[model samples]
Target chain A: MTTAPRLTLPAVTVGDRLPDLPYDVTATTVVLGALASRDWRPMHHDKDFAVDRNGVRDIFLNTPNQAAWFERYLTDWTGPRGRLGRMTFRMKGSVFPGDTMVFTGTVDEVVSDDTGCGWIGVDVTLSVGGDLKTSCHARLALPTTDDDNPWSRSGDRWTP
Target chain B: MTDLSADIEALIGVEQYEEAGEFPVERGYVWSTCSAVENGNPLFWDDDVADALTGGPIAPPTMLSVWFRPHHWAPGRDRVALPLQIHFDLKEALGLPEAVMTENTIVFHDPVRPGDLLTTRQILRSVSPEKTTKLGTGRFWVIEVEYTNQAGALVGVESYTGFGYRRAGSEAGVAP
Candidate 1:
């Protein structure tokens, strides 16, 4: 399978928009993500437990599941070389089965730190039916040049 | 600090070290996770690609916490009603019936690879006094978990903030 080409620092600009990622949620989607994350909470897989115990409409996506989707969305745009430095997100609502989750993001800043690390700031949102579910702010490291690999930086050279 | 109750105040800055995950990271598990998320990042799927970027085939950075998630059931271990012990503790302490995570911040430090065994230490960062939110009236708390690989190298750190509240009309007013 092919992946997006590696992104270089100079290629990015503030206000650059990432391609929209849309996913159709289903019971299988929720359960699979939970299982993959090793989360065995019934509320993530059992509808009765979710509806009765949790008092939600149905089983919903777990924390790590949503984080996985956010990482997937960001990496899909930056390709493999764009290494994440930090990510912070606030959950506003739940994303349940049958909801169509859309991920939209825009570049907030681009900078080369004193250590020569290239950083890109992004603001992202996960929404369902135009209603917000989560808002995210992420910082990732990109290559300053074709030869520079952000992953190679460590210790004092790397600081998120 | 004055707003925090005595019980909640005592938990701040206390770190709890947890046992290692049951199994080491496995390629099969990693592959399944990638499939589940529909993530086609070659770093997670192709060793050659990953070697070029992250030094070797590495699990997705997002999967750092997945490595330390406790099993739902074991041969001798009792089944847990909740996934997180702190959540249970906070609920019991604050007397809140419902809880939800509001925010999370994670910093990635090291790549987690297949065959790596991971462990975690969690600390109670802070707790808020009773307050009203759209969800209801309750308290807010923040917990931070630090992940480490078998070699004792820090892999990542996650600060999770949650709200434990009672729905409207049920203990709805602010704390007395």
Candidate 2:
């Protein structure tokens, strides 16, 4: 098994763009997410119920799924060393099953506190076919050291 | 309608609340959810990766939401309905113009792996009535649902905001 490279802080910038992560929303996928989250709402899994009842084309993506997408997007950038401090998101549109969703984000801002911990703010968005499905702001705690080693110091804020 | 505040108080601050049924956590189900979120990472599907990170097979963060089923009410039993079906029948029951998922907050205490039996108990946090353009008067309810594993370990808590709306008299017949 190949281990992911340890991510370093101060590597990302305000203008840096996250890679576009693409995925297909399938019936099986939707049901699986609903089952795992224990969110057995019919609008997330039942096709007929979504169409006939909610007037939606298909089962929609739940909020937790959207948040996970953000987490994945950031983790891919920060690697294993970054820690997510907070995330706030708003679901603008419904993501029906079969809809291809793409997640993208940018480093909105960055700052360092008195303790030398790097605080990065990001504006992340999830889109389906060019339409915005969810948008959120996230704050991540990164290391201030330039050393490539993530474990150089103990009790770092990014450990957890 | 059933004294929402009172219903909420009875459910909150309780350690072990009863659930209607159990939903199995299958490997296929975990992969499916990860795929839907556009996450193709092998960590979620590959056993080798799972073993490296978690020291065992574990479910993804979003996977927990899919595994939760509503608390089913036996005919005469006292059970709080979650209105899970109302999301589908919005037009008939409330004539809701739009149902939007506004926000979500989740806290994870433990990892949910395969073979972990889970149960959920929901508590209504707050309900705010507001006005909308398409749907005149609407309500947004914040519900906090806590999930625990079979061993009585708190797995996570999911806070979801669901918005229900009704059509305005003037815009009721207007076609978009």
Candidate 3:
């Protein structure tokens, strides 16, 4: 439904470490993300505007840009079956062009439910050169085994 | 004990609202957003794939923030939307004109379908007192939003956190 349901490892457990993803934050990504989210704030794309008006070194990432990064990380790890339940994050500093962001996380909690789904929590961080830029707490509803599709359920049945 | 704290204190529970009625949910926008992020989730675009689950194409849950977002132009296409109201004013009053959004929490209660006209309201939740972090001393505040479709069905909710801070200095709230 939502995910591809392609490859899944054993049901995740607490303390399981996710793969480390190191990416270069480029000007294209910064600007594209702003456009995609429809966040027209100049600081996200116009370097001159950022430094001249906002007082940052260069054009930087926006909230939706950061959200995209986290979204990709979660879906990539859980494959297509990982349904996002809730996500909470805090921005600590700015992520600028030429910065390499390393994403890492650990499984925080897992709850087995009768609805044939497993609710998962992951605490994650996005850092550049060892300086933390963002921290997030996310809840994902993952299918148990292959047939457990969380997307087909009605709104009244959504899990917490 | 920084002067910013008291100014921020005056803002707790103050709310500002921007309303958009009966908005269209376009497939192109959803496809573009998912494509930009490199998310291959077929549910966003493939009707055959989506039909297998949602009975129709479904928007990515993360797009909840995008739909019903107020454009730079104010409603009725009259003029540029007024400068961000409470958020900008609070930051200015605190003398921390420079601020960053450090936290966001979004919960999806319902799937967004293609062509669903959505409505939403955003509220200013709470503003914390000045706190010192590695970045600097600043105030953290929450903006809560609730989304519903034209049928009056709930779609989702989001709590976005903004941390407005000044550079660290010798002040009591500045982090070392």
Ten-residue stretch with the least lDDT total in model 2 chain A: A151-160
**Candidate 3 Cα misplacement greater than 4 A, ranges:** A1-10, A113-116, B1-18, B21-23, B72-79, B82-102, B127-140, B162-176
Candidates by lDDT, descending order: 1, 3, 2
Among these predictions, the greatest TM-score belongs to: 1
lDDT per residue as tens, model 2, A34-147: 654556678987889999998988888776666666777876777544546556678788887779888888888888755566768888888989999888887766656643
Ranking by TM-score: 1, 3, 2
Candidate 2, backbone clash total: 19
DockQ of each: 0.68, 0.32, 0.47
Model 1 interface DockQ = 0.68
Q: What is the C-alpha lDDT of each candidate?
A: 0.86, 0.64, 0.75
Could you give the TM-score of chain B for each candidate, in order?
Answer: 0.88, 0.64, 0.73
Model 1 lDDT per residue over B56-161, tens place: 8888888887887777777877664333578768887777888888888999998888889888777898888789998888888888988888899888999989
Candidate 2, lDDT over the whole model: 0.64
TM-score of each: 0.91, 0.64, 0.80
Per-candidate clashes come to 0, 19, 5
What tens-digit string does per-residue lDDT give for candidate 2 at B1-176? Answer: 34334543463344334463345666776766666555555556667856765566767654556665444434665755443433333333334555666777665556677888888876656555455645466667666667888888777676767776655654432322
